[model samples]
Target: MADPSNELLASALSGEGQPSVVQLHGEESPQRCAELRWLYPAIKWWKALRLRGEEDLNGIDAYAASVDALLLDAWSPKQLGGTGHRLDPAWLERLEMRICRDLPWWLAGGISAEWVPTLVHQVSPFGLDASSRLEHSPGVKDLRRVEALVQAVRVNSGNRG
Candidate 1:
């Protein structure tokens, strides 16, 4: 839901032991994330940034100003996310300096074990999401691929900034 009502968000968060972090997966717009944050002062909102053509990253700091974190993913017309698509590093290179310095972001979409070294070198995301890419089929992950990805992350962990 791109713009879930304040009433809906409050209702979801009403009960006891509310989750500390919530990912706005159904929401694709980055600008609306700040508005959601404004509605919920206590909860941590993780906004998924669906990167598309001409992503107006010049004002990203304003777009993601007070959010807890951001998730970088490729924008798909059919799928809101989990599309198994990779974001172009050339365009992402421009975002390295544009995103808010303290706001951590996780890289998603077409991340694979083999791409880790290059990803660590080109992008500075705080984390990576490889569930769909490391899977042999839907809901079943290839352990070898998962291991390779884990190993790759470990190998490149020290190389990141």
Candidate 2:
């Protein structure tokens, strides 16, 4: 979930939480992300995913200083998230060198086994966010597909560990 309320995030962090990456999405500003981080210092904030075109990158880059990772997702006209659409690879390629260097960024938006390995090589994202492609329906992920994709990326990367 992206841009969750501060109360909800705080409650989740109150438990035995580990250092996890949280991707801020939706209409959240970098200032808001900073506020949430201040409210809960236990959680490590990752990149924020903006829906707008290249324009959103400015806000994202501004906030990137405080985050541990960056993620680029597709924008849609109908819904706020889970649009099952892929972002412009070229756009990511251009920004890959400038914004997220040395940061662990993940590529979201309908990634699959067939495309994940190639995109991983092209964009060189730290990982792939597989959601719609491995889902039997909306919000229901297919484990088999997910496992296959994990295997594929690992094999392609020659990462046996």
Candidate 3:
């Protein structure tokens, strides 16, 4: 849905829903996230930052504090999302040192269940955001695959600890 209406957002947040975090993607600004927080106080807000290259990270460290969490996705310079592109691991590494340590974050864009353990070891993010990887098609999540992925991550995390 394109920028949810305040009433709709409030209704969704107030319903009998599982505990969830609200992640806003598609070039959402900090101000937009702030407005979402004001409209739906119950849901945690994450701002998606699309990094096209290293230079795009310039002032992100300073901007990250206001967000509950940051979501790093591959920048397509042309599209909105689900471009099936992977972000540079080196750029992600630098970003981890710069922005993620102090706050909760998730890495999106072309992530798969197989990548979970390595990503957890490398970034130690609060979670992973799997869209296309868990989907049979855009907007259609494969429940079985998603469940398997959850189980795998739990097993892996337990082993690590």
Candidate 4:
């Protein structure tokens, strides 16, 4: 939360092809999000939160109100991220589309080419995250599946407008 971490974020901000958005995918609270927003006003913060069950439904608004966007991912007892497990679609469904009006959000975890169309149309997230499952080994990705995922999103997004 100090120099080394922020220096990394700052370098990304100032480096070539600087990213317009960055993600904070930890156990940071809404107050922390607000603080970071103040610290780096130019950065678009996407706060990633894992959904454990139906009981967490109400807490979505707090995160949404705090950040530029929200990324709701599948929860696992062991992993912090990249669990390759999915949350119940019904849980995400209750978030409603209205939230996207002010701040776009994303869905992550266990997403694949097959579910892309349904997820794009039904859940209607601002974006999706596909990792873990796309990898053949720890860090080695199977490009074919990545292409398939991209193609699916393209096909489904075109249907939107």
Task: Return the top candidate by lDDT.
Answer: 1
Clashing pairs in 1: 85-110
lDDT of 2 by residue, 1-161 (tens): 46688687767666564447566766666677778778767667765474457655554567675666767788777765567788777677777667746667777887888886667666677777778889998889899989989888887784321
Instruction: List residue ranges in candidate 3 displaced over 4 A.
Output: 1-22, 31-43, 158-161
**Each model's TM-score?**
0.85, 0.79, 0.70, 0.82
- By TM-score, highest first, what's the ranking? 1, 4, 2, 3
| Cα TM-score of candidate 1 | 0.85
Candidate 4 Cα outliers beyond 4 Å, as residue runs: 1-19, 97-100, 158-161
Predicted structure 2, TM vs. truth: 0.79
Better of 1 and 2 by TM-score: 1
Local accuracy of candidate 4 as per-residue lDDT tens digits, 75-97:
88787678889877767777764
How many pairs in model 2 have backbone atoms within 3 A of each other, for residues 3 or more apart or on separate chains, i.e. clashes? 0
Candidate 1's error at 97, in angstroms?
Answer: 1.4
Of the two candidates 3 and 4, the one with more favorable TM-score, higher being better, is: 4
Count of steric clashes across candidates, in order: 1, 0, 0, 0
Model 4: worst 10 consecutive residues (lDDT sum) = 1-10
Tens-place lDDT per residue, model 1, 1-161, is 45567787788888988878888776545556767777777889887778775464555566567578878789889887778888888677788777777888898998898999998888888889777888889879999999999999998886854
The 0-to-1 C-alpha lDDT of every candidate, in the order given, reads: 0.78, 0.71, 0.71, 0.77
Q: Write the per-residue lDDT of candidate 3 for residues 1-161, one digit (tens) a residue.
A: 23666686667677576347876665556677677767666667777788788888777765464568887788876775677677776776677777746777777887777776666655566777778888888889999879877876886774432
